[model samples]
Structures are given as C-alpha cells and as structure tokens.
Target: MLDQTRRGMAAFGLALMSGLAPVSAMAEDRPVIAAAADLKFALTEIAAAFAAETGTKVDLAFGSTGNFATQIREGAPYQMYMAADESYVAWLAAAGLTRDEGTLYAQGRIVMMVPHGSRLAADGSLETLRAALAAGNISHFAIANPEHAPYGRRAMEALRHQGIWEALGPFLVLGENVSQAAQFATSGDAEGGIIAYSLALSEQVSRLGSYQLIPADWHAPLNQRMVLLKSAGPVAEAFYVYIGTPAAREIMKKYGFGLPGE
Candidate 1:
C-alpha cells in the first residue's frame, strides 16, 4: 500500500511539472522607472516603502537627467522619468511623450565636497574653496558634466558666481553624472567636487568626506519633477501618484530634498 501511495504522489508531481495540471496565475509585473542620479538614495528608500505598502515592485535606473531624457525620446522602454530639473519634463511634455504636464516632486541642493582630512577647510563658504584653489592645494576639482547634468550646470554657476570658474577651468574633472562626481570626490580621484546635498548626506558619502552647502542663490533652482510616459502601465501610474503622498514626501525630506510646497 505504501509503494502504491508513493507512485500516486509521484504521478501527480510529474503531471504538475509537465503542465498537465492547472497552475496558479503568474505574479504581477514591476514597472521600470528612469530617474536622475541625484534621486539615487532618496528614491531607493521611497521605492522600498512604496513596495512594502502596495506589495508591488518598482525597478529604478539612475543616471544623468539629460541622458535619460534623450533615451526616453529614443524609446528606452522606461515607464516613467524623474528628473533633477523640471525643464526636462516640460520638454518631454512638449514632445508629446508624457501623459500629462507631470508633477514637481522635490527641490534639490548642491554642495562642495572634499575627502576627509583634505587641506580645504570645511568652513561652509566658497571663499575657503577659493583660497584652497589659489594655494594649489587642490589638484583636481570634479563636477558632473554641465552639458548633460543639471548639478554640473549649477556647479559651474556657483563657481562663476564666486569668480572661480575661469581659474578652476584648468583643474576640473567632469564626471558623467552627479553620483559619479560624488564618487570622484570620495575616491580621492579629484581633490574636491560639487555634488548633490542628498548624496553628501548619504551614509556611504558621509563616511568618505564632508560637505558645505552651496548658497541656493548661486544657481538656478533644482526643481525636480516626474512624469508618466505615454506607454506607462497601471503600476507606473499608481507609483507616480504615490510619490505625491505624504509618506513618499517624508522619505524624500529625510534624504535632504525639500518637499514640494515646503
């Protein structure tokens, strides 16, 4: 009798494996979101909380906003785009690529960062940076590529505002994006760099160096925005709206972003 029972169970298992038996439905799909490099830390945390609440997953790809915008225009298969600048969303909207005008999510800030123990004083002022550069103590000052990275543009603006853009030209090391610029600063590849305040507050970056916030008036506002692409699915749409919720805003705030309307 036991041998017969074993044979019966084996037959049932074989039938299931061979697709001869009814099976449960496949799991729901996760939407892909293309986001700016400056959103790396904050969005990751927000996505996790979103997943925990909704039981849906969101896959994020972080890079320079301009690159992502170009890729979106080229049909990169991303369901949504979150940019460090609102202009990118407006451009996408004008191209008829987005479902709507999009939403402003957060405002970001930039900072000057140097590896811990560097000669540059952490005085939280550009004059300190100017003095270090004049002393020849900073061999390379890194920043995101201003051509495609908003942070880099702001970095350049700040330097120009401080009257150091011309002098720092010879010592600049440009990264592909803000995150890479932070990496350059942390790795000591560049003696100092301008990067997102959010990244500077991240534990990974905080351990490697210290930063001083750049005056907001030095550059254009970093009004971050997000949009659902024309091809966005239900998950993407839900997540897009979720970002405006209080929970999501709080997480962004924790990461150093100024919540919209605050």
Candidate 2:
C-alpha cells in the first residue's frame, strides 16, 4: 500500500507539472504608448529599463504629436500619449481623453546634423549652411513637416528667426517627423537638417553623422509632456508612474533631455 501511494503521488506531481504553464511561455500584455518622435531613443531606453526592473513590458509607437493627438481623438487604442509639447496633452485633456492633466516629462533641444565627412562644417552655427546654399553646393535640406510635427514647427521658427526661411524654402525636404528628418540628414538624402538633440545623441546617428546644438533661443522651448489615457489599464498607469522615477530621468538626461522642473 505504501509503494502504491508513492507511485500515485509521483503521478499527481507529474500531472501538475505538465498542466502548469512556463513563465517564459506566458507573454506579458505590454501597454501601448504613443510617444513623440523626439523620444524614439530616450523613451525606448526608459521603457526597456522599466521592464527589466519591474518585469513588465511596454509597447511604444513614436510619431508626431499632432498626428498622435488626432489618432487619440479618433479613438486609437494607445493607453498613454507623450507629446513633444504640453499643448497637445492639454488638448487631449480638454477633450476628456486623459485621466488628468498630464505631467511635463522633459525639454527637448534641436541640432543641425550633417552626414559624416560632409564638406560643410559640423559647427552648430548656420553660416556654413548658408554659404553652401549660396554657393549651390547643397541642393536639399530636411525638416519635419511643420503642419503636424512640433519639431518641424520649431525648425521653421529657427529658420525664420535666422532670416533664411524663404531663402531655404526651395531646398527644403520636409520629413514626416523629426526621426525621418534625422534619417535624411544622416543618409545624405538631404545635405543636412535640423533634428531633435536627443536623436543626435543616439548611437545610430552618432555613428553616421555629427551634429551641432541649435541654440535654444533659435526656437520655442520644447516642453515635453506625458499622460495616461482614459483607456489606460493597470500596466499603462504603472509605467506612467515609473516614467517619473529617477532611473527614467537619468536615461532622459543621458540622451540630452532636460529634466522636468529642473
């Protein structure tokens, strides 16, 4: 009877083991976050860190704040929205799309980038660019589309402030968003372009090009903001809070973002 009971217990243990799902097999349902193009790298690093520490996952979709605002307004399924500017977050909040007024995450900066080995100086000043254009050496330049991208609008402001908006108009190659603008400049598709400083600091861009910081006074401040959408689940809410942690702030700082309230 003792041997029989032992066998039965062993069989039951095996059955239990067979029925249990492996932790690796069970995928965590990562919450979807719509983040600004400027955060393509910074937020990605932050999200990966959040997952490593908390064992929770997050899905990030990077794009223009204006495009994202429209999608959220039209009922896109994202649980969180991080904009390049606070105004978009406020717009969503006013539309009753967010849990509350969103929190400022960081301030972004712009830089002018040229592909590696370009004849034009990589100096942050626009003098080389103007000379190149006037000399007909540079045929194209890129910027995000000002209509729906905050960075693009800022680029426009910078160009206008420098009194070169109209002169450079014919050579402008507008990108869908800032990341693409960076790509264009890095790939030499456009001679060079103004893009987010965060991107300029990224490994990929760093490897392919050099950038000079566009003076903050050249354009409006890029006060980035993030909000938990009304449709956000627990995972999204938790990640939203995690974004405020020191770990996240450090990652942003590493990528050239100015910490909020700093």
Candidate 3:
C-alpha cells in the first residue's frame, strides 16, 4: 500500500499533461485530491503523515488552479481541490461542483529567484530585474502563465507593481505552473523569475538558486482555499479535516506558506 501510495503521488503531478490518466483508476478507496502546484511539497508530506496516522490514503494531483477548475467543471473525478486562490474554489462552489464554498487553507507569497551565476540580483524590489533587462543581461525570465496559475497571476501583479511588466515582456518564458516556473528560473535557459515562495523554499529548487521574497502589498492576497467535491467520500473528508491539524499546518509553514489566521 505504501508503494502504491508513492506511485500515485508521483503520478498525480503529471496527470494534467497525461489527460488525467494517472488518477483515473487509482485505488477506489484512496480518493483523489487536486491541488495547486505550490502545495506540492508541503501537502505531499502532510498526506504521508495522514496515511501513517490513519492507515488510509488519498491521492493528490498538483497543477494550475485555473486548469484544475476547468477540469472539475468538466467532471474530472477529483474528490477534493486545494486551490492557490480562494476565487477558484468559490467558482467551483458557484457551479455547484463543491460541497461548500470551502475552507481557507493558507496565504501564499512570491519570490524572485536566480540561479548560481545569473546577472540578476534576486531582489524582492525587482529593481535589479529592471536593471538586468535594461542591460540586456537577462535572456529569459520565467513565470507561470498568468492565465491559469494563481502564483503566476501574483507574479504578474508584482512585476507590474515594480513597473517592469512591459519591458520584461519580450524576454518572458512561461511555465505551465509555478513549480515549473521555479525549474525554469533555476535552469540555465532563464536568468531568473518570480515564483511561489513555497516552491523556492523547497530543497530541490533552493539548492540551485537564491531567492528573495516579494512584498506582500505588491499584489492581491493569495488566499488559498480547499474544498471537498460533491464526489468526495469518507476518506477524502477525513483528509480534508486533517489538513487543519497542527501537524499539517507545521508542514505548510515549513514549506513557506503562511497559515490561515496566523
């Protein structure tokens, strides 16, 4: 069962591009939970702990919130959804797809990250980014597509607040989601980018680059929210409740998510 859970978790993040096949027939007993890409590391740890504590498992698929919203509306069989923005959950509720409006899970932030040898300064003010752009030292700057990902949308807002949105346009390279944005920022193809603070905190991404948090006031609040779909069952409900537990909240904090109400 542990092996199966690992496999399911591993495949969930890829389900978007795979046409949702990875989660198609994952154990009927293990409910599928669609999550925002920023929650990948934190929620993965939380789920493992939940499984260990309860002897039951849930599958989690991480991707762009807007894309997940579209999938849920299209009847994707997801029992739960954790969106990086509360608006998406509210939208699902309005569509009568979710059990309720949903619970506020966490608040998120963005950061500017640059790889080891980049000309960019990884400054939260984005002034350095503007300077790099003017100097032609920035080849490509990574960001998730603002059309779908909440973090991406916030990134765009922050850049706009910094007054560099237009000039940076010609050098932009978008990732499908924030996690992918982090990858691109640290990869040699791009000099740097704004990505989820949670992703930048992860060891896997941080090892390759340095990051600085953007000001919270620069963008609208990233009030993350989660909901149980109408298709949710007992296991999924338990997992949803478990996310509010102290253990889970700690994991979220460790991954750079600001806990709700705290």
Candidate 4:
C-alpha cells in the first residue's frame, strides 16, 4: 500500500509541474503577421507547414498592403509585415516601424481568369479581351480596388496600356481586396477577374477555372517585400529566417511565385 501511495504522489507531482510551466515556454511561440491579400492561398499553406515543422503557430491577417500599412501605423500589434509592393514596406521601414532592413521576397505576376467551362477566349490578350466585352459574353469583370490593392493598380495599368480602359469602364467591378476580387470571379457573380497568379494556381481555383498569364511588361513589377517589426520576438525572427530556406522556396514556386532572379 505504501509503494502504491508513493507512486500516486510521484504522478501527481509530475502533473503539477507540467501544469505549472509557462504557456510561452511550452511550445514554439508564433508571431502575428500582416500580409497582403494576394498571398492568401500560398501563405496559408506555408504557415501550416511552418507550424507543423516547428511547432509554432502563425496568426495571419490578410488585406490590402495599403490597409495593412495604415493599421500597422496605427499600432495593430503585428510582428511582421508582408506587402505586395516594396514601397509600403520601405515606407514603414523609413518610419522606424521595422527591425532589420526590408527584404524582397518574391515577384508577383498578374493574370486573367475565367470559370473552367466558360466560353471566353483562352488567349486573354488585349484584343481578345475587347472582343469578349463587345460580344457581351461577359457582363462584369472584377478587380481589386485600385485605391489600395497593388494588383488592382496593375490591372488598371494593363487595361490602360491596351487602350481599353475607357471602353471597359462601365463593366468594371471593384473588390475591397485581391482575395475578394478572386471570390467575385469564383462565385460567378463576375464573369472573370484580374488576380494574382499565385491565387490563380490554388486548388480551389484550379477546380473552378482556367487562367492566362498577363504579359510581364503590362505594368511595373509587383515586388513583394517582408519586414520584421521592431516588436518581434525571437521565435518570429526564427520564422522569418525559415522563410528563406530551400523548403520554403520550393513551396513558393509551386504556388506560382518566382524568386528574385527566376
């Protein structure tokens, strides 16, 4: 009976110790990330894989880079910021909102997408776009709000470059963010959309549609940049470092993102 009593006491003590450990010390701590909307699909997969490998959790907030910048400037408590354009990250860095210098992570490309079985032309060039609009084959076209979304701005630039901006003006539908624009297209409310190539390659999208890559020169390069915030913890720093690993790079590539030179 005494031996059994001792064993019970030992088990109780172990349990107590386990329960007393600091929550922060029990697992790899996660950081709060403010990310651009175009990175939705890829970032979600990347974040999940990162947590599985390192036992860290990632709290992600997705929106337009401009909106994120405003939130960060207003003290949103983010430990890192990933912007669709380098300008926003640079601006935040210049304002001393970040720790280390900003790093260019990826270059995003634009694309035109339509529902999988839609009768729209597959070429998706400027001429085909105009022809489709004239034929009334497409009623509405969605785009991220150019006021905030870099992708939206690029889409506008592409339209203007093709000299069809005014002609398509009446049919343009604006979404609050790039992801929302994609939702508009995917839901069939809009016949098609201008969205990020990364999002275009997502399984959810693949099952619903086909996409055509827009010419690279249609607008300025969509240079994505990531910055470590001044309030970032050690774990956040480690996660940032992990983003540069070959494994992460491979994952990025699978989602249609290209590295600096590629």
Global lDDT of each model?
A: 0.80, 0.80, 0.83, 0.76
Off by over 4 Å in 2: 1-28
Q: Per-residue lDDT tens digits of candidate 2, residues 1-262?
A: 0011111111101000112122321343677899999898888888788777766678899888999999999999999999998999999999999999989889999988888767677756688887887798876777888889999999889888888788888777777778877777777555788999998898877777788998899889998999999988877877888888888888899999998677
Candidate 1 lDDT over residue span 1-262, tens digit each:
0011111111101000111122122333677899999888888888877777766678989899999999999988899999999999999999999999898898999998888767775444678879887787777777888889999999999989989888888777777888877877666556677899998888878878788899999999999999999988877777887888888888788889998678
Model 4 misplacement above 4 A: 1-29, 117-119
C-alpha lDDT of candidate 3 relative to the true structure: 0.83
Put down candidate 3 lDDT per residue, 195-234, tens digits, no spaces: 9998888877788889999999999999999999999987
RMSD to the hidden true structure, all candidates: 15.7, 16.7, 8.8, 15.4
TM-score of each: 0.88, 0.87, 0.89, 0.86
Q: Which candidate leads the pack in lDDT?
A: 3
Query: Clashes in candidate 2: how many?
Result: 0
lDDT of 1 at 172: 78
lDDT of 1 at 208: 83
* Cα error, candidate 3, residue 14 (Å): 11
lDDT of 4 by residue, 91-147 (tens): 888888898668888999988887655556445576777888778776677788888
